[model samples]
Target: MTKPVRKAVFPVAGLGTRFLPATKTMAKEMLPVVDKPLIQYAVEEAAAAGIEYFIFVTGRGKHVLVEHFDHAFELEQLLGARGKTEALETLRAAIPAPGTVISTRQQNPLGLGHAVWCARAFIGEDEPFAVILPDDLILSDTPAIGQLIEAHAKVGGNVVATEDVPREHTNRYGILKVQSDDGRLARADGLVEKPKPEDAPSTLSIIGRYVLDATVMDRLGSIGKGSGGEIQLTDGMAATIDDGVPFHGLRFEGTRFDCGDKVGFLKANMAFALDRPDMRDDVAAFLKDMAAGL
Candidate 1:
């Protein structure tokens, strides 16, 4: 039986050195894409795909993040008394349903694999689960996680969100060796992490969304650290490929913003702000003036 995908893990333990000063006092996951924090967007995507349990793998100083999900009763009461009805509704929408969200600490800054390992008890056994990297914000007609969930139901091994990158850029991602390409989906023969440009098999690179089988956890458990000093999830994923457990790279319909990168982060802010009805006119006018002056 294909175990229903009910749980998701968000590894938000990284010390966002990329956005140093801003991240110094706050978790990068708390950074806003527009009005919503990066982590909120990830949870919303998973919730849209029918995820029943949300697990966050976090480090220290993330208390505010947990509070973000809790009931803001006092604040809500104040808003109600002040007659800020529409504003109050917006705040309520961001709060997840009671008892659905949970978090655990990842003691050391091991790596993505270690962060996931910390959630093993929550995942238990006999079920598939999802992992969403909050850094990959995909703007799409369909939610990005939903795309992976749809493919997971059909293909049944591991479904990952993938998009073609320039061949030269493949060196920065987990490049896939294609077994077959049915256009929308590419069945991968293997996953090669950060391969040199000439050695890369295909440009289909892994993105942030993953729907992984429970068996893969066993594989991840036995794997040793590779490439870097920390345990690598890519190494575990590559093992699944060797075990002949199927894996597919799905070219989802969307524009993906690599919000982990500074430039991509700026673009996401601009794109989302410009798309909002309330902010569009002023934002666009400001952009036009800046462009004309430049």
Candidate 2:
């Protein structure tokens, strides 16, 4: 029987250099999309996917990322006493149950691979785990992480969320070398990290969501620095492929927003605002007027 994917690792250690002064004090993951933070959306997606234990790989001054999932007693009391029943319920709903969430620190800004390595102990030796990048906010009817988990169950090895990018833009992502593709799932012969347009084997690029077997952690520990002189997770995963591990890419159903970029952040805010029933009409009207004025 395949081991159930019970825990998820969230790599939230990056310094949001792009978002500057605003992130100087606040963790970028805490920036709100509509009303909820980016990290909240990732967590909610993981929870909906049946992830029971949430492990956050954090860095200096990123305590707010963990705190967001913690209960605020004073604030809850104030809401309850003021008879704000709806507000209180919403607040309570966001906090995970006691002992289910934990955080571990990545002491250096090494890379995405190192950040995930920091969560190795929690993943143990044989369990399958999920890694979610809060920077990639994916909106879909079914949670994005859940989609990867479903693919993992069917394939029983490492499965990454993939999307087709323009061939000219393949250099920006970890592109997959297709062994075979059947519309939704593509079996990868190999994965190349940010290959040049001409060298890219396929247009399918790996995104933020991943369902990985624990063995990949060992590979991460030994791989050399890649790409921008930092340990790259793609390198670690590609190594597993050489060991004959099954690697697949799932074309998940979602519209992904890269919230790490300023333009992308603004777009995510607008898209998410337009998604809410309470605010959609007003937001659409405002956008229409703004477009007309421009």
Candidate 3:
């Protein structure tokens, strides 16, 4: 029987330099998308995909993130006194059950590869796992991680969620070199992180979600730094691909927002605000006033 991919790792150690000043004191993962923080969306996604245990590879100044997943007595009591049943439901929905969530520190700002390596102890030996980057806020009916997990069930190898990016924008992501094109599922021969446009293998960029084999932990071990003098996760995955281990990309149906980028973060906020009934009106009016000035 294929080992079930029941655990997920979230690499949230970044210093959110992009959203600095605001992020200097706070973790970007704690920033709210609607009512829930970015990390909450990712955890919920893993849970929806049938993942049982969640591992958060966190860093300094990320205490609020861990707290967000825990119970809040003051707020619960306030809601209880006010008879706010509906409001309480929303709060409960955002938080995962205690003990199901866990955290480990990624002491060094090494890179994504090192962050995953930090979770190795929690991951243990020879079971498949998933990784989600909070920066990639996937907008879809189903969580993007769920799509990758479903694909992993059929193939029993590494699976990465992919989406078409403008050919001109390939440098912004980890690009996949395809061995065969099967549309929604591509036979990935290799992957390169943030390649120059001329060097990029294909326009299908790897997003945040990945159903990774625990073997990847070995590949990540003491791996040499790539382009940015940072250990890239693509390097490890690329090693697996070259060894003839099957790897596939799932072209999930969704809008992806690179919440790590300033413009992308603003767009996500606007898009989410527009989706909320109460905020839609005020947010629209605010945008209109701001646009008229522009």
Per TM-score, the best of the predicted structures is 2
lDDT of 2 by residue, 74-131 (tens): 9999999999999999988988889999899999888999999999989879889999
**Whole-model alpha-carbon lDDT for candidate 2:** 0.92
Estimate, for each residue in 163-221, the C-alpha lDDT of model 1 and write its tens digit. Answer: 88998898788888999999999998788888898999988899888888776788778
RMSD, every candidate, angstroms: 1.4, 0.9, 2.0
Highest lDDT: give the candidate number: 2
Residue pairs whose backbone atoms clash in candidate 2? none
What ranges in model 1 sit over 4 Å off?
Answer: none
lDDT of 3 by residue, 1-294 (tens): 568888999999889988888898889998888777888878887888788998989898887888888778899889989999999878877777667888999998888998998899988678899999988998788878888888888887789988888888998789999988778999888898988888888898888889998778888885678868878898988887766668898999888888998898889889888878989999999999999999
Q: Between prediction 2 and prediction 3, which has the larger lDDT?
A: 2
Worst 10 residues of 1 by lDDT: 225-234
Question: How much lDDT does candidate 1 score?
Answer: 0.87
User: Could you arrange the candidates by lDDT from highest to lowest?
Assistant: 2, 1, 3
Clashes of 2: 0
Error of 1 at 133 (Å): 0.7
If the candidates were sorted by their TM-score against the true structure, best first, what order would they fall in?
A: 2, 1, 3
Number of backbone collisions per candidate = 0, 0, 0
